[model samples]
Target: MRRHTLSTAVTLCFAASLAAAASAPSEARPASPPASQTARQQARVPVLVDCFFHPEVRPTDFVLACGDGNSRLTSLHWSRWGQASAKAVGVNIVNDCKPYCAAGRFHSYPVVVRLDRAQPWKKRPHLQHYSRMTLEYPAGRPDTFPPTVTYPLWN
Candidate 1:
């Protein structure tokens, strides 16, 4: 008789639990955004592609002269990196080539770097890259360079 009472009580408790669960509200899930909105959010920022085709953002050092390492940017501090443009301040190290290309002294000049004209990268169409780079020397520029110069970055 005791065993029968205990079994009845256990079954009652189990049935009550099921009933409570059936009446409970379902857990809510966040609604997903529209496909267009998701795509826009996922759009990648423009990057500076290195000579080896590696993308870089806020690089401390970058080689402007990929072939001979004659000119480069060092100690870069980027102020802005946006969809349309990017800006930075760094030192432009230029090889003077006083005697010849093989034997030249590198000179440092204070410069403001601006990257603009963003377009879809040919190598990675889903992403964008800065196509143009303009360098403005604030003071003591390299002898071979003007106060301001612009170059078309390789795609």
Candidate 2:
């Protein structure tokens, strides 16, 4: 009976320790940035750029969020990583285009993406400093568009 009690206690303690380790936060998690309005610096700012779609074949369309607002689109790029990492974000709106409409202007918009060399580079609300974005667009009307994209680092 004494042996049984000792084993049970040890088992309980081990389980508790494992649980604590599982929930602990690590260095990979950075702190959030402060709001500074003096400069055009973006608090939750993403590296953004507008690109034109040059189609070699006919034109195709994808979904997107766009307008005169922040989450809007005007022109599009394929994502520097191409169709494979498109989910990490390949295209975005180009406001430079006057009137904001033209052939191959894209319709299906994917969410924002972080184009980190690492797969699934999710954005953390607490991250400080700027993260780089890789912009890609439909070049040559090329016969491809990424089927998936990641979020936060859209260009």
Candidate 3:
């Protein structure tokens, strides 16, 4: 009789445990992502130009936030980067160095940005850098002192 009662109690407890488990919520599973999202993840990543002050994050048509409020590089498209030269087209913004740099008018000039001896950036090994930036302004530039400008990589 004791054995029968013990067996009945065990069976009842086991059944109650299963019922509680069945009533509980199941664990969540992650849903599959959309096809478009997967395609975009596989697409080629764009490269960005190093503007003066701001850190380069991603490729952009305009070179932005150089910290110089009046001047910026824009419409930049880097075509090729060979050992000798890297070709690009953009517009250069030159602020007139007036009584003070702060109170100066800004001007935009069409330019071709060329990079020679392109190499990997020191700080960011993955990113590319040029030994120098040769800006060729086809249109007339503003009448500022030291009109011709070249940006050096190491400096």
The TM-scores, one per candidate, come to: 0.72, 0.21, 0.52
lDDT of each: 0.79, 0.33, 0.54
Residue-level lDDT of model 2, residues 20-96, one tens digit each, is 54465755344433435412343232222222211111112222332222133323343443322222333343322
Q: How displaced is residue 122 in candidate 2, in Å?
A: 17
Q: What is the C-alpha RMSD of each candidate to the true structure, in Å?
A: 24.9, 20.7, 25.5
Worst 10 residues of 3 by lDDT: 51-60
How many steric clashes does model 2 contain?
37
- lDDT string for model 3 (1-155, tens) is 57455545554564465456446554432344575763353232222345432223223343333443355677777786455566777777766646445444457888777667655666555445455667777777767524456776452
Clashes of each: 0, 37, 0
lDDT of candidate 1 over 87-146, digit per residue (tens)? 999999887765654445668999999999999889878868899999999999987678
The TM-score leader among the candidates is 1
Q: Give the TM-score of candidate 2.
A: 0.21
Backbone clashes in model 1, listed as residue pairs = none
Candidate 3 lDDT for residue 134: 70
TM-score of 1: 0.72
Q: Please give the lDDT score for candidate 2.
A: 0.33
